[model samples]
Target chain A: MVPPDERSRALVSVLGTAETKVTFEDPRSIPEMVLAVVEAALEDAALGWHDIDAVVTASVDLFDGLTASSIAVTEVVGAVMKPETRIAADGLAAAVHAVHQIMAGAYRRILVVAHGKASMAPYWDLTAWAMDPIFLQPLGVNFLTFAGLQAAMLARHDPHAVSRWATTAALRRSAATGGIAGPISVDRVMASPVVASPLRAGMCAPVGDGACAVILGDPNIGDRNLGEEDVRIAGIGHDVGPHHLMIGELTDWAGLRRASQRAYTLAGVTKPTFAIVEPSCLFPHEEELFVEAVGIGTTAPHSPGGGLFAGTAPVISGLSRLLRVVRALKGRTGERGLAHGTWGPAGQGQVVVVAETP
Target chain B: MILESTIRLPFSYAAGTVGSRFLIALREDQKILGARCTSCSTVTAPPRPFCSSCSRTVTELVEVGPDGTLEAWTNQPGNGVFGLILLDGADTPIVHRILGTINPGTVNAEAINMTPGARVTAMFAKDRTGRITDIEGFIVEQDDP
Candidate 1:
């Protein structure tokens, strides 16, 4: 546990995973998936539900096809009769909000949870609703089309962008071990059937259902329940770009750059460098944008565990990346890492987190 | 047992003053309207009530274009071609369906005459409903000999 004097604010730790298919025969319900992750998080933190003072959850009402989707997980998250806030975007954004609560001295320990089940509804079809109803939606411009437009623009900007993206997709998939979808070669990626023009089937992250839970607390509480190793959430930042695609630059993730700058400033990172970086890159081209926006060298260790290409749940992808970094830095000393998450068309919303082994 | 049920959610969206006027223009005059931000001088098609850049409430509605240039485009499998068109007078491009046949599936440089910088003009539907779809789609403007 953290000492009383150092009880200002910190993400005590995190835990979770993503699966393309939860079960072979029967698919797990939303609450069931959320419960499993919550229980595992408590186990990892060695804390009980009673110890959690507040809860922050990430879920989209349209994705669940139910209003107040957070209510579905309230009982499982132990948020009944307690303060619970829901973030309708990526899970990492929810985690960032929970950090604010701890820092404000509103809660001693906060539980952050996120879940997404793509099997319930047609994922891309639901994404269309997120578009401007009057203008873009009527034209049938969904997430895939927006991605196609961006990829096409990138290709147009750089003649070799298509081949480069194919290489990146192949590398990421090949690095994935025990993923639901197996690896592919550059040739195979380039030859794969086109879903959206330049974006091949192999270049897109396989969508799936998943749930993640992370527990954050003051340093004093963390130090009390001392474990073999400890990782602290040093800083967190998130930004929302223009909702309309016409308003912002399609190729550059300016929002991510702003978010990362805020996070780096808070973490006292003068030079942006990390031992490992896990980016929620849903598309191969997005990984390229992420690297450029975050100011990380091309050779920097990125998504060693294959990232979203391996198979990522929609809202849960970002939080899962955080979980990966936390777990990776747990035993190591003097190691720092970064995890990035994005939402909306062409990554309009971005969240970044900086962490270190203490 | 697999239980199946269809959920239909009924919603009523208030288009507000700006949207209502824009729709009226499209339906009555077959004219495209855009909202001009006085602060930033940026015009957005399918006119909105507010400007995104300068955070100013825009009340001036301007007639933009019957013709526009295609900035980017894609072919949606079953759906016909669609492209982002920067209408003649608007600062931003509006995404709309492209009528006429060139290619059917996949977004390629050669498909549906969908290269960047292509010229197109609005083709209004015969039956107007004061909705965005009333302007059925955009047709590629042919070059004169």
Candidate 2:
């Protein structure tokens, strides 16, 4: 028999969630953008700024082009005097930290926020700075190069991989409702400029500027809007794979698999039977890798409304995915949802969170 | 209206003991080096202090290759063509330029087979620096031998 998770003693519920429409460039500054999301999230949770006990945020200095970039959201997230923790990776990772604090009975309510702006500079250019200066960086190695290399590795065995990726990108784009790069044809996607070998511009997600905020709290704690049914986080697991793309499993997402397995065990999910799945796949080829890693079979409703293909911010992607799952669970359909996040070159870091209506 | 500003920040990184050894060998003797793991037996080129897989400190630095197999490649239209080369002795691949001919920029990409499993030999630069660029690129092996 599988052992039950002992550390998750307290059930952490997501009280509220909010996000901005992802755009190529947000007109407002970082603080103003964060403030809007914070206000909406507070309103959704029916809590005042004073009610927030602590704040956790996800951001990166290289992406934000500012040291301690999380400072921008301090006043908005109600962290002026309270303790605040900043995670330099994906937004969902911050939520995971918030979940940890809530489970530890550290605070009654914690606010998690993540923000990113691709428009500030050439986003891909910034990623090159993260690679090994001694070996990879001088060779002009960047994240896009990593994607192309992975796709090329996968295409070696499968003759039809390229065509399939084009189809997947087209499907995702067409399904997107308000996506910046709306509904492109499969033919057009194939003909689009090749950013990397075997991967085209159309096969990539539309990156933009945005912010996401979510409030988590202990249901046992008394609040004015206490409800019997709430969307609670059931499980969370994160794993960082090998940093080097060459040495690691280039064709598979080993880290994501392990993370999902750990999360599944905590959530008591015996199979890949999620009502909805939100994965942080930046490329169309990655959608295939995500499916294989999570072991989600043909039936799971994955990435509704085109998911990241619709358009998402860099650090905010994983967190925004969590928000989507939270919103869907509010219907109280007894549905189980999965939210995933990834960081570093390729799938170097992977985080998974499981949520359900209770 | 959009205002753009170009900012330049200079930085320096120490190559460390193992990294210095790897680069020194490439420059001094046109030889590729890989650090073998004490625990997992995995060898990673452009060697490091510890193994990427097992996290065990690697002490045995072995010669990897002047010849390797092309694992995968990409041709960025404006940028150059690059490939993942699986060195002869090493288990893992390293990313580097895949030079099709004497002049890479002018060569026709389709003329050369960019597919995996093609054999290639490393070409070293005449004037070498203790850097990754010491090995200029790998050229596809000719069959006329």
Candidate 3:
């Protein structure tokens, strides 16, 4: 028995990939936005419809206002007649699931994709559904509320937390937007009105529509046609914590701690100091939470310049982090990088991935 | 232009399964119940017959708290009202409407503030319906009235 904790597996590399082409328009339609991502992934990977073996997509059916929304997305990703699986969490969750397939000797290669657009429906509405229906629904709670509660908790203790979050948001947004969305200044973030106590509009992640795609395959049959530069995935782990935010200790993300410990063991990471970390931080405060939970402290440069506060593509946000790690590692900027994704209120579900340069 | 039509999805609760029976019980007596996993001894609200963790059928009935703490709260921007709530007894949280106006300043005040850890109590409608909405929603308590 591998023993659940010490289960080490061989590494797999992420093949050529592409990010969604930004179309600066409000209320972006799902079909229109998703097709662009599919087309871009196909073009970037230099692969046609015939190259893909199976497709794995991540999406929440309720968010799309359609049940089994993955069915509609398959055609765009070229998954017609291919085995498909839908993950109800972040894009990174689907990517991790794909890695499992490859590790289990099930499929040789797979296409992992995820998409989310806050334009089609209210993002808050979608987040609210994740709450307890009988008790929390009537109260009308959403993710932002949790952010507010966390902010309130921080504000009661730390004097500089809110200001620091504002600074982080401004810095990230500036780096992510280059003739993309209009530049937002630190002054703008400071001046933005508070949506929830202690959390301002600028501190929160901007809702945007986008899609992400990643191709994975065994290294033995490494095809030169699919980009020579490869970033290998060394370790991956995920955990779900207590759903009730109030009952569990909010300050500590124990779920993240356990997940990172598992991932580091799998990746043989004795020391994570030199690692470049890419984390899915919807809000600046969340960035702090993720960093603290992973035990990286302030030692590692996170998101390089910015994160989801830069602009989030919903379910695709986590995979966006993975892509960021891939780009950074391929550039020789970092030897090993940590990418983390969190779902539900106060980080209910957590996933961690460690990517290293081969 | 692509043409689309509005699809109405109307479904009913058969209450045949044990999970449905519990829902029926909640509607009949405003009793909140949960299914306890035989293997792990974890009680799940929105009860599940099969333990998600152990993959074993949960046959034990564990009546959790009729009241739960308000873990989180929010108001729909427009149209209808909704919130995410975790009940006292069950492991899973349920979403329902708040009985009265949302108060932002004080916990569960008439205003629109959804502070975490706000104390809330469930309110059932006079008419009985074997659906999740039968509870109408939960209300944040100001004090013993």
Candidate 4:
């Protein structure tokens, strides 16, 4: 894992990024969603489907309720005859895998699209089914339960934790102008119905339907419209934590911390600072955990524009975080940033990407 | 109109050699089994053939607790309380339901202690089946709080 820096000149660039506004429920189907983002991303990159050498998609069979979930978007993603790889986890993971293709000198351009419709079914039940059917599943518990467990553990020590988490949720929701999750005052948040003990509905990111698409291209070889402030992926890192919540450290995102260390190593920088940082924190407490894990002091413009509290699709949350970082860095060029993504109960899985202006 | 349909696929999972023995011990003798990894010296309840930490095979099955300490627990609405119990002689905690009069109607706070490090014992179901549920749930043998 070498940083795509001086040692490796064949680095991957974010040619384009586009995503539909995360909503309570998208009226369009998966294919239509793919088509919309594909067109917008292609337009942004100044390229067409023919320019993309391969397609890497992020979707899950269980999430889509369709076997081989990628089949639905095959035509729209322009993967008719080209090579395609599907990642069943977070959307950012798909981009991480696609970067490998470019770094290996295989593909010049790869289109990464991740879509999810949380409105399709009861999302928590699906996550519960993802657990070990032997022990955890029969208990009828899901990710929310784990979050509650973790929160209770955290709050047990810190008397002010629940109130602080409520304030964090209210602040994020108020900043979340995307309209996916309506804003609520701190008092209202405190009064919000509990989804699980300690974790109220107001504290959770209102998951809904949305899709995110990004175009990753070999910066060295392509009719690349080399923009001066273009933000390219300098380093990529991902780690899978132990599946059992009991076995792993629950209070902090140890997996994300490890992934960031790997990324910082690959980026060739030991002590790093960023102008922007985006974390795929589905819950408010997670934002605090991610901030502490990465050691990025909470003062930076972290998760500008409300982060996941603005509303985001599950599988695409991490990739969506990357999109936010890319979009943010585009305006304020020549600055470093990090994007984080996590999956499974209590952040048992994590991925991080370090991006910077070239 | 939104299309709504349920996708159902009935399936059965074969708990491999280690898991089978662990379940069988509970069914036949009311004994709890755990595997100690030779390489890592880590004990895993609801034993797996392979150690999750070191990826090395743990074939030595040892009789583990009918008692353990509650590492953590949560009260999931609509679902009863669940806890991660670190059985005596095991490093990893096993997640299971908390048994006792926990039904909301009779949920005696004093009877059901949810604090971490609370001592509990495995209670076997009278009607034993070869499943994790064979042990109805862990009872509060000694409430820490």
Candidate 5:
């Protein structure tokens, strides 16, 4: 029986990291995307495909333009003869599900991966399907439109909301530079056209192509754990709010608060002190909302560089946050950290992970 | 010069366990079937053979009443309105378009316009065939008031 409160005795580790080989013209296919993530996980875990027990992947079928997108990429994950589950939400949601399997005493040494290539389809048009068909979709709403709603709501009270969001966008775009596209300046962001009222095109995360993977195991294995360094997944929690406009409070995210409370309780964290905090901030306004929802003190380091605005790959955004937090924890300056991820329309769903150096 | 590269994605789909069968059954019977999970005792509309909650095999199938109450409803000015109707015999709600009974303009006017326990009934097509569209949509049961 899988207890809802069963703490994860199984510690998950991050291994070799390789992203999709992206180009303006020829981006990596889904199969190739899966292969890239598989190689990274196998190398990082210091094991071969023979060592893997089961696989849990994160993807949305609509985004992939294929029904049961996992089926197409399953072979490349090397799960030909193994158990696999696909999470329809964000990458972090998939990671959370994988942690449950480990703690349930179901299997040991599981692989969790997520990949997204936003270049394939029209992201805005596609995201419309995620909204409540009657209320939101008819408004022609997508993530950008939702961000506009959130931004406009905030701007109504604080006139500086637009400027602050623009500044945040400039910062992240500059940080994301050396990757696929180059950097942007505050002036450039200010000059960009408004995609939604109050939210200029510059205030959003750049759609990109990438894949990520993590290897989790029953901590009771070997002399130590799976990865060269032991990184324990202390707590995991996710929640979905009522799918309606009237019920959801536009100014506050009660769902994120509930999710974090549950996660902190499992991790046994009373005081959240960390050198790093990574949030899946798709828009600058969302970054503010996230920091407020998580109850992070002003003193706490928040998205040290920039968040989704830097580079975000839909389903992989949360895993990317995890990767950022892991890198921070690996560095000697880091101790405990938090990674936050969200999906659905207007942050209707959320997941948080609290991990500490072991 | 503009370079247009054609992309084609071809793959066989499951038609989903419930959605595919619902189409066939709707064509033949004009009655909707409910998938009842033997384990949790949950019923899904336009039935499937498996329980989503328990992931257990559905043991029984039953025809739901053509009559149900509007649990919630909404409309789009130019598009359409969708509602969740809680059928008389089923536990879960079925989502469908609310046809002539509710005005599309008023539906989209505000979210609070939808009230729970509001009585509504299915409006079937005159020709009578088994298909989701066979039930043209739901109509407000004005005879009760």
Candidate 6:
């Protein structure tokens, strides 16, 4: 449903999701992981390295513990002589940026690569550095503690909040395929040791190392013979809330609501209806916020692929959700699907992408 | 095979004009300063250079309360109690540790007597550096009859 002028700029289509593995231990270097995903992506797209016009990557220098971390993967992504952009945030944001470049007629084909390895160092320790040094850093607050704060606030509002979170965690983990975490029960979830009060260890997503790459191209530049399995990016939108957690309402995700509204408007979807929805919810409470912000009623099918609850790399979680949605649409699981990604403390950054079968 | 190595990277961080001023206030006068945005009439604690809500430069500096209300709190496993405190004159809350001998990690509501909306007063450390840790933490303020 992209407008006429925009449609000609580039008909952005997702070629495929490539080589994503969730594991606590990946015996591969950062560049090796990048190469693996890039190779897999090219093979799935039925194209060679020469076909890619530009590259966009997502990785945090802090997480990688290197300066200009993207430099390590540039050669593998086939960006030695081409234009490459790096997003220090989540991978879904990088993909959305790639969509803009194609729509602006900058390039016909753009390859998006995102990678994260939680095994590199203390993940939470690095995250603490992202906080306001003067105020937050001294308190030793990290993403997990922030999540705990949000969960406690939500618990104050709803009496059965902890129980609901436990159930959601159990269901998502059970539905996960190729997940590092096995199926867990609600009782086990409740009995699990508390990471943050009101949020048990079982309710948190398993963080691991993984990489994902997707090749997108203008429909005209690619093969003329189109197939029913191809999926097109119908709409995309992203938003960043205040950097400080105290600035916004802790209970609701206003940023996601804004992002999803923009995407829905571009996709010309007046109703909150979808065949499938995949949200990068690192915690069960976050899934509740996503559903409320996106205005998807309780009946809508959500995260059939298990979402982040299964096991997701920190920075790669969002883009991986997109991969799941694309695969679902291609497999005839849904005609229209929604994928959501988030970053920063307490969902400060949000992105929504709407994909539909061609 | 499993391989492990430690890599240490050294770097220095600069706290700009706004941050420097906040630190100076704490070091010299033991005062908490916040910036007030005239456009939005919002006061942000620890003073940011710009008003996030209005997207305008905030030049007016105001001294907020040594007393505040706890908005939310959590007890870290090894660490002590931490809470988001809404200072008396500021619109935004500041995250800090709660100072007390009683550990909220193991105590219940009745034992700790700390909950959301509880009144607390800032307690400064004896050895003050121009850092955020100058104010050690907040303690429960007893009500006067």
User: Which candidate's TM-score is highest?
Assistant: 2
DockQ for every prediction shown:
0.51, 0.69, 0.16, 0.54, 0.04, 0.56
lDDT of 6 by residue, B1-145 (tens): 5567666767566777888888888888899999999999999997898985687998889999788988777766765577778999998888888774234333222345566778887877778888898888887654431
lDDT tens string, model 3, B22-129? 778778888777777878876777666666456588877777655776654443334234444567767655555655533433334355334556677777767866
How much is the lDDT of residue B29 in candidate 4? 99
Q: Per-residue lDDT tens digits of candidate 5, residues B1-145?
A: 3334544665343535565556556666677777788888877665656774576888577778688876544443343445557787777666566664444333222333334456766766777443456666776654422
After superposition, the stretches of candidate 4 with alpha carbons farther than 4 Å from their true spots are: A1-10, A298-301, B100-111, B142-145
| List of clashing residue pairs for candidate 2 | none
Question: Relative to the unseen true structure, what is the C-alpha lDDT of residue A217 in candidate 6, on a scale of 0 to 100?
Answer: 77
Q: Which is the leading candidate under lDDT?
A: 2
- List model 4 lDDT by residue over A251-276, tens digit each: 87888888898887777656657877
Better of 2 and 3 by TM-score: 2
Candidate 5 lDDT over residue span A146-232, tens digit each: 555556556655767677778878777777645455577778888987676566667777777778787777776562334434566
Residue B38 Cα positional deviation in candidate 4, in Å, after optimal superposition: 1.8
lDDT of each: 0.79, 0.85, 0.70, 0.82, 0.69, 0.82
True contacts kept of 5: 0.00
TM-score of each: 0.92, 0.95, 0.76, 0.94, 0.69, 0.93
Contacts from the true interface found in each model, as a fraction, amount to 0.43, 0.67, 0.10, 0.43, 0.00, 0.48
Q: Tell how far residue A229 is off in model 4, in angstroms.
A: 2.2
In candidate 1, which residue ranges exceed 4 Å CA deviation?
A: A1-26, A226-228, B100-111, B142-145
What digit string (tens of lDDT, one per residue) describes model 2 on residues B19-70?
Answer: 9999999999999999999789999886889987778899889999889999
TM-score of candidate 6 chain B vs. the reference? 0.86
lDDT (Cα, tens digit) per residue for candidate 1, span B39-62: 999898878888856779999999
Question: Once model 6 is optimally superposed onto the true structure by TM-score, how far is the C-alpha of residue B86 displaced, in angstroms?
Answer: 0.7
Instruction: Give the lDDT of residue B77 in candidate 4.
Output: 59
Model 3, stretches more than 4 Å misplaced? A1-10, A23-39, A42-50, A65-67, A106-108, A127-164, A179-198, A225-229, A241-246, A249-251, A344-346, B1-7, B13-145
